[model samples]
Target: MENRLLQILVCPVCKGTLRHDREHQELICPADRLAFPVRDGVPVMLPGEARTLEQAPEQ
Candidate 1:
């Protein structure tokens, strides 16, 4: 994602900053506990299209 685009993109629900997960190709909103996927270089920002995050395993 371009820096400019990423700067302007916010979580639709909380209007919070998004952290780019380059490996998974997603824009994550920790505040919302949701992950928006990037498909073919395009972010699918719709809430209905988002996936809830499962808790990561303890290390």
Candidate 2:
């Protein structure tokens, strides 16, 4: 994701800052424990499309 885009993107649920997980291609909302996927360089910010931190693949 572009640095500018990442700077502006916020968690749809809590409106909190998101942390980009480059290795997993996800934008994570730590407060919500949700991971929004980034597919084809486009962020899928839908709550329904998010995965809970528990469901995140083990590092």
The per-model lDDT (C-alpha) reads: 0.88, 0.94
TM-score of each: 0.87, 0.93
What would the TM-score be for candidate 1 when compared with the true structure?
A: 0.87
Runs of candidate 2 exceeding 4 Å displacement: none
lDDT of 2 by residue, 1-59 (tens): 89999999999999999999999999999999999999899999999999999984555
Candidate 2: what lDDT?
Answer: 0.94
Candidate 1, 1-55: lDDT as tens digits:
8989999999999999999888778889999998898889899999998888894
lDDT of 1: 0.88
